[model samples]
Target: MTPAPLTRAAVADMIDHTLLAPQASPADVDALIVEARKLGVYAICLSPSMLPVRAPGLVVATVAGFPSGKHHSLVKGAEARLAVDQGAAEVDMVIDVGAALAGDFNAVLADIITVREATRDRAVLKVIVESAALTDAAIVGACRAAEQAGADFVKTSTGFHPAGGASAHAVRLMAETVGGRLGVKASGGIRTAEDAAAMIAAGATRLGLSKSAAVLDGFPD
Candidate 1:
């Protein structure tokens, strides 16, 4: 069965209006804050470097170990802490997909734990599992590890992975695994109201969308 339509407030609350593109300029960041304030989006996910100057009055967020979760755990942890100190309300850290696929579950757990500890008091931590790169089992494993590491949410993708974006199956798996304990963020390639509703129906409490304006524009209040 299809899900009911999401109210404007519900859609607004679920969005982490994102601007992670390399071409994102200072003016773009400024415009983002203006739009976010107008829409009252859940947060404005920005690049870490922009945190110091652009974080005020914004629900500031930074991506850790970013698109490619290949960075050393220590580096990700340090980045997480720095982002928090710079006034980030939330930190989205990518999991080491290589380690996860190789069955190095300990490495995956350790990586998320490092950032989890670093951001414990300062900001909420969301671990991006990059679900498209993993098999169902791997997704479950990552969700379990994220929950164990005290992550506030288990995110679906980084939008850079060639594997693709949020899927209903992946969202359901994440929700079934971590819904009650930790929130699920369905990100990457979400561009329409219908897509947003599908992800939410599949159990996404948060959505990271770069195409926020288009999505909301198509769904008038």
Candidate 2:
């Protein structure tokens, strides 16, 4: 399917400029903020610790439960709250992959619920299913549970996972399952304009990309 024509401004609004690299310095984040402000992307995703000092003009986003969702639910909840308090407009929390693999639906639900409640009035919650690590059925189940837990978006991967990032099949499945109830964010490995367009065609309303400048540079004004 062909992607709908998106203007520069529209494409800018769809992007979530990401900066989750281990080697990222404060100067790097400052540069990221400058780019985000210039492009007017949807948000600037940062590590939780950086949210306190990052650009207040940009919609601040941080990951909770992180690449590995092995953290305790309470810890995730506290992290979400603290990020929001530190000026985060959005919280992307990882689901417990082990619990989902074990069919422990309660654990998955509780983990998401805790973080969701903690950020209820403060920020939007996007549940990261880490799609690269799961089977098709597991991905669907995780999206459903995230919706039930009151998440505003179901995100594909954390980009740090060994398995890889967003896939067309996962994006389609999430869109079909969530319908209009929630947003689908496709992150990881999306470096080109074509990749961004493809994900948007597959029903992703948001794109989390570390290479936002490069991607937009490939498109004409």
Candidate 3:
């Protein structure tokens, strides 16, 4: 059976409209909220510091462990707990890429579990796996660890990593690893409608994009 063509509204609903730049000011986040509302996005992803923001009708997501996943697991858990307390409905926590790369999925699972316990059902948890920096085997391992740790989603990248961002192959692998049990979020460096469509076709259930309006504009209504 052929799949239906993706519509602009459908794509917008899949997007986590993002503004995670380190230098972004409170005013910039305010502007991002306005843009997200206008674009009809599902959520707005921001730094944890930007929490307590109001994006009525849109899910508010914040990051823990951030661009680098080197933080101690306890610290990441605390960050997630605090963000949830501050009104963030979702938390994307970065895992230690080094653990995955070193074939230590047990450590990865433990790290994610800490954050999962901290959120305690108050927020949806997405694990950022830094897929671009990992080998395909590591990606699979990381995704499996995320699932075993009870994350709600497994995200591709943080967009700040020097290596790269989301790709169709990574999204596919992640989706297959979780096997419909968890959402696959294709994030980072996705700037065009074509890119967004490809990720969806590859089994990404969610998207993370900094250029939400431009990408949505490229799609037909």
How many clashes in each candidate?
A: 0, 0, 0
Candidate 2 lDDT: 0.89
Candidate 1 stretches with Cα past 4 Å from truth are 1-4, 54-57
lDDT of 3 by residue, 111-201 (tens): 9999999998899999999999999999999999998898999999999899999999999999999999999999998999999999999
Q: What are the RMSDs of all candidates, in order?
A: 1.7, 1.6, 0.6
Give the per-residue lDDT of model 1 (tens digit) for 1-221: 87566787779888999999988898999898888888878889998877765645567888999879999999999999998898888999999999888878888999999998888778989999999999999999999999888889999999999999899899999999985789999999899988988898899999998888778776658
Task: Output the number of the lDDT-best candidate.
Answer: 3
In candidate 3, where is summed lDDT lowest over 10 consecutive residues? 49-58
Reference-based lDDT, each prediction: 0.89, 0.89, 0.94
Q: Indicate whether candidate 2 or candidate 3 has the larger TM-score.
A: 3
TM-scores of all candidate predictions against the true structure: 0.95, 0.95, 0.99
Better of 1 and 3 by lDDT: 3
Q: What is the TM-score of candidate 1?
A: 0.95
